[model samples]
Target: MLRSLLPIVEHAVKGPVWDCQMCGQCVLHETGMTCPMTCPKTLRNGPCGGVAVDGACEVKPEMQCVWVKANHRAENLPLLPQSWRDEIGHLRAPVNNSLAGDSSWMNLVSGADRKTPTGWKGSE
Candidate 1:
């Protein structure tokens, strides 16, 4: 219903600044709003071994690695949990287009087609 329309608005708002890939597992809350999809390697856990001298991404030398920036921000933000600083890992799996324009928040809450987090809710 109304929640379904929220994505259309969120996509319009968050897409530009965040380069939102619409991964369906939005990690913005975990990553200081730096979209993990911006990582060329899509490395969710952290920077790959090849982070450059200036902390730029190895895969995309011109750009800063999102994880490095996320770690820094995570440290300063009071509400962000300490565990998020160490909790880098793969985000579910790549989502298909069928979920392209949906509300990830609602999907996660409803447990519709979403993949549960590992070790969450007794998942293996």
Candidate 2:
């Protein structure tokens, strides 16, 4: 199917370079529409001091901070359980390689192998 072939074609032409938005919607929406995975700072309760009055991130001035965006989304939806929100605050995963190498998108489309763990030592 073309879906499966597209990644291979892209990889062949472009190597492994890809862009990631790092939106935690996948984890947030299902659990309670709360995103912890995407936000680099991983703020649960609210936006950190980095948030500008207009709701832009200090780190990436052009972009709306993840926490600011998440807060807005959460406010529109029903209130999420405090425990679920709290749990996300502590959970952190390396956003890039984690998705690129291991995502089901790559698995189904490209049949790419998961990236070797950091500092892995193969036996001779």
Candidate 3:
């Protein structure tokens, strides 16, 4: 089924393009397809406010700031659902490593996961 094939396909396609870590809770749609793994701080929302003048990452100056690009991209798209828009910085849940490299779509289908934003925490 399509759910079973999602992991393999995403790893192949998004892995190289986005440096995806296969965290099994894809936020690409909310993030303008920008992978948070690309951020040195692993920030899921937006930039850390330390971006360089050219919109380069502060932690890795040579790289473009993903959040900046995501913000810009969001502007041109149709309005997202209020929840998605409200979750710009707060929606990221802790990655469940038990599900790493698996199908997040399947997780959603099984009610094991959701795209809804959750509170940040230091430990489970």
Candidate 4:
């Protein structure tokens, strides 16, 4: 019951605020509270080297690059802790497609996001 409702509630809260894609393993804290999944290219690591001089996204000239916003917020957001600001440069794990639409809250409690996904090492 709760397992089914978690995703719905999570989406309801995160969707409009972060343009959440329900990637299930959220790195918002790591990425300055910005959702990299919302990027047009969904480039998890960083920008695609196409950011304009004015800080606009290459894919969408009018929109600011997600990484740019992430880095800026990571550094300048007064509410963020020093540790979170320092984490913007860390390399993040690739998206776990199997976890899509699942509840990250549950994954965090279960430590499911920490374990290597099945078949990532070898046959499950």
TM for every model, in the order presented, reads: 0.69, 0.38, 0.70, 0.89
lDDT by residue for model 3 (20-109), tens: 888777777777667776788878757898999899999888888888887766555566665554455554666566777777667777
Clashes of each: 1, 0, 1, 0
lDDT of 4 at 97: 86
lDDT of 4 by residue, 4-23 (tens): 99999999999999999998
Model 4 misplacement above 4 A: 117-124
Question: All models: lDDT?
Answer: 0.69, 0.48, 0.73, 0.87
Candidate 1 residues 30-105, lDDT tens each?
Answer: 6765777778887666678888878998877788877888777766767766677444433444444466567766
Taking all chains together, the TM-score of candidate 4 against the true structure is: 0.89
lDDT of 2 at 21: 31
Model 3: lDDT equals 0.73
TM for candidate 3 is 0.70
**Residue-by-residue lDDT tens digits, candidate 2, 1-124:** 7555754564443332222233311245322354444456654344678778888877778877776666555445556666654444443333334444233444435433333358655333
* Candidate 2 deviant stretches above 4 angstroms: 1-48, 78-90, 93-98, 105-124
For model 4, state the Cα shift of residue 33 in Å: 0.7
lDDT computed for candidate 4: 0.87
Error of 1 at 114 (Å): 5.6
